[model samples]
Target: MQTISKNITTLLLLSVVFSFGGCKKFLSVTPSTQSVNPVTIKDFQEILNSDSLSRTQFFPLDLMTDDVALTDNQFNTGDNFYRRIYTWDALIWNPAQIDFMYNYSYAKILQMNVILSRIDAAKKDALNTPQTKNLIVSQALTNRAWYYLQLVNTYGAAYDVSTSKTDPGVPLVLTPDAYALPARASVEQVYGSIISDLKKAAANTDMPSKGIDIIHPGKAAVYGLLARTYLYKGDYESASLFADSALTQESRLLDLTQNPYMPNQLQDLNTNPEVLLGRISSDEGFFKTYSNTFVIGGSLLDSLGGFSTADKRFSNRFSTSRFSPGVYKQNQLNAQTMVFDNSVAVPEIMLIKAECLARKGDFSAAGDLLDKLRSSRIINYSPSGRTYTADNILSYVIGERRRELCFHGGLRLFDLKRFNKGTPFRQSILRTSYSGTNYAELLPGSVLYLLPLSAYVLAANPNILQNPR
Candidate 1:
């Protein structure tokens, strides 16, 4: 794996001579085949169309959340790298290893910058007109916004209006130039850039009304991204509005009731109506490989509830591990079963809208929306039968969010960080090693919530400041 040092080297090289279509492996600096710099709209589109652009550039963060537990033998003898992450280690990376999340996110950001820097000057053919340019720009902007959002949430403090202005975020690298080492922008600035990009992307009406495919961003995808971004920023009203906008354009939730016990029913993004924009970890089988050693946490399992005709998410998505008999693990993530889609999707947007409604004292409306979503996932679900009191409605929504969204993207970690900023959802996560000899706890206000920059990253960029540990 190439570290930030190699990324910097790659960038310096690309600055001198632009190339493409080399290095099939993740983080390969040199392309095996080199093409000239993009001088046409088609070239820009080709760069954006690469599947690697949509792939999550980091190790999955689900290991760090409370939703996973370590098995006895594996925790004791398995990979130390994952164990370090599972225990929320202050420094998870060795000196020489690459920080995949940090480096690859910036790598994709560099690609976006390349397109944004010269799209206007590129030759426009009969088919690739100004509207085509707008569409390409929209996709690039949305991609950059999403990457920055992920980087800031992982490296910087959780967004707080009071402290965001000063809270250090990841470096705001905008141009294709890679020689200058930029300092971390504030969390507020990072968020501001994300929102600006999404809004700009959304305003480009020449783009398709809905995403052309799950891989590309369209108007609905832009709205969904904006909704989630605002939700992370703690702007409920905007979140609700944008989510509504997105759902209106494309709100096709999968009926989990139809295939309750099927192992891989929702694997195809083209057929999956709910996925607005699909993305997976670069190593898509990470979960499946890890399942031999990790099991679903007791609390998360309890929230999912026992086998029932009412709810099918647990039955369809999880099962006892064949590698470790009698232990339960999520069976439907990764390439073997159902590929997990971590990007903007219909169900998540619905959940966002429901949460916003509940937070705004519209419990009835929120309950209705939640029940509507539950009905699709749960057979014979009755809204009247659900005992959702106004007092516990928000908790119910959050609990459902946990059950539905766990192990997808790094959302659980993101939720924990943001929820800790308030009272109702603030929690102290406690876990012990398989040997029960060592324990790790993450308190609501702990500095450990903010991950430290890898030693490699710090070494590569002298101006970058590490997060407080």
Candidate 2:
């Protein structure tokens, strides 16, 4: 594990070097006979394709949400960082602690910015044709938008149109100037910039049909991201349209029942047809701890109801660990290390479209979409028994979303925030230890839902403001 961590760090450092010093430094330091840095299109693509840079850290996100809980012994002996996050402590941003989520996000953003800044030079050098250059630029823009979306959602507040203008978002760093210390942008500005980047990426028709690797964002991935962003912002019409666009490009659902069992399954990139894009954590120890310490919340298990038997997800994704009896721990990937599927998958897109249709009062259309996904997961699903009306359609869709998306890629926390805007859909999350003696609660609309920026960030950039406690 230590070796793996070192390798990941080395890759990130390499990415940083290429991003900051690639072409310019080579031109200055190399002999006239030597070739310049990033002399070809592949050089730029290689930087964007770094596995370490693309695999985001959202393990802390899983701990902060209600989907997971600690065993009695695990809770007592857990690291301070995990404990603090699990309890929703206001002081979780200690500078001494390693905030992988913050650091990795910014690192990838820097890499994307560097690529975007140097792409023009690559074009002028004739290393890439006009079409290839446009495609490369589009990929960079998509990556930049994705990284910013992760940063703002993690370090800043959820998108609330009423308060977005006043809310502190992550700093919008669009250039490769590492020394520049910019103040945090408003949430509105950050989201607008993300939308703009995605629009540009989507407009590029020459983008490769699919990424050479799942880490490289493709045209469908672009549309999928746009759909996700609009969905988070509560724009149902745009979400539906973009989701439709993405599905048209690529729609492949992994039939869980068909391939029900596999040993040490890590959900590798390009292996799953459902995955339009994919990322997995490099922190092996974090995943081992998560699997050993955490179990599904009791309430969540009950919500599974009959579906727990009919749906292969229940048996496939979880198991009763020897650490505790009757306690179920998540093992979706069937690996000791955490390998999350962060890409836009078919099931997620379907749910997004269903929810949007429900919002627009298209009960029949929404119900059909929901039924299609449900039928895929449920062993003996019968549509005749499943009927949804407008009043109950949204509720059903949201419930299915919870079941389908939990523990995959930190969707639980984001869903909690996005749906907790009002009284009707607001949720209060409760987590209890194995003995049922120790517990934590995160109420709906609580300021704690918005994680604070790392103390290291605030110390370095005095102009940056912290999220409210």
Candidate 3:
């Protein structure tokens, strides 16, 4: 997230989505486009099992935050270009990100819907202790919720807590169709459907709560997402409760018990125990980048007042050099840098707890929680300096999130919009340096930022509505 921080060396854009692919498995879509036997559950699940599909699912796949990368040196809306996303001024979408967002996302949504439709058929038993069919249904609902949530974020606006209940959101399509165009739904309706799906996910106690649900849906994962939806809606009490629910069973945070900043430890950036949910993306074509073209790691020391000794991220994670920030990456990389990999850590539930509490007006309590995380991540601990008046506590919380949650996923951009902090970066963002989209400004509540309606989408639903300019 930092232009380049001290120790963090990985390019966040590589895995900026919910996931970055390992190129571990090639995708093989079922039904072969014409085999037409009403796509079975296992067949659909097999498609979901592909490494590409797992890495490129909704919400996680399309991250355009302050931390991610662009395909071109500059932000231009063209084939395979990330920078162009900054300029929606072009007559048409750059197509790569857009096609993935609208066409691919909806296609995935249809896949989930197909699985959901046949969940009952998959169930051979009426009363089962633990059945595969039940798992499929529960997971399908959860996946559907997540996919729609991602769709909403791309095509729709950031969830507005004040008017979301009355706001129109994206269409909640469950069943697949070759024909049948749909219109954009209200934000309220979109969130409503997503919540309903999550409830189904939470209710299914039979499901396990383990690692990332990139392949399918997990109860804990759904709860984790629900927590975000609630946070976006400004419903802190629920957000806190759900975040607690997600983290209650396990702790996936990087286990940084061993001193992280020790130089020897810095050599093995990939295995740093602090990573909770990380993906090393070898297929994103980062290794090909020139060695010096890597994400700057030591920028924090230069920018954030010489990197406070108390800041754990600087002391432990960054390595300063004359050129690059050298935070986590021991060496630098350039385009065609496939020998290396990109990663994403699905941040711990503990941070979300702090965020939800801070949003809820419990500044004293929130500060205590935030400090707990800060202490763990810093070279030195000073609780005395952590005190905050209620007035400035939220700002402090937002700042802490920026530091702790940088370059993890698509979060920085969303965080900027939610707290209304994009103005600071409008001109200062170093558009040519990183996140190359030369967005003169982060569009505040504009229709342009909304995903362009796909041609298929427009043709299907005659009554479908386009986003307002």
Model 2 over residues 1-469: C-alpha lDDT tens digits? Answer: 9768765664565455544322311111221111224545666756655554455668778778877666677677755677788889888866765566776677667767767877777645555787878887898898888878877787777789899997888889898664568999988999999999999998987886567656667888898889989998889899999999989988877777676632232235557777676655433655455555356666566656632366766655566345453344334555455444566677888899999999888999999988888777778788898679989999889889888887655677888888787837887877665555657788898999888877787787898888777
Candidates arranged by TM-score, highest first: 1, 2, 3
The CA lDDT at 122 in model 3 is: 51
TM-score of each: 0.88, 0.87, 0.70
**In terms of TM-score, which candidate is strongest?**
1
Candidate 3 C-alpha RMSD relative to the actual structure: 10.6
Over 4 Å off in model 3, which ranges?
A: 1-48, 57-80, 87-98, 123-130, 165-168, 211-217, 256-319, 326-348, 380-384, 421-439, 443-448, 454-469
Across 182-254, the per-residue lDDT of candidate 3 in tens digits comes to 5667788888888998898678866777433334446666677777778767678888888877766544544
Task: Order the candidates by lDDT, highest first.
Answer: 1, 2, 3
List CA RMSD, all candidates.
5.1, 6.9, 10.6
Q: Which 10 consecutive positions of candidate 2 have the poorest summed lDDT?
A: 25-34
Q: What's the count of clashing pairs in each model shown?
A: 2, 0, 65
Model 3 residue 227 lDDT score: 79
Poorly placed runs, candidate 2 (over 4 Å)? 1-39, 123-126, 261-267, 287-293, 306-308, 320-336
> TM-score of model 3 relative to the true fold?
0.70
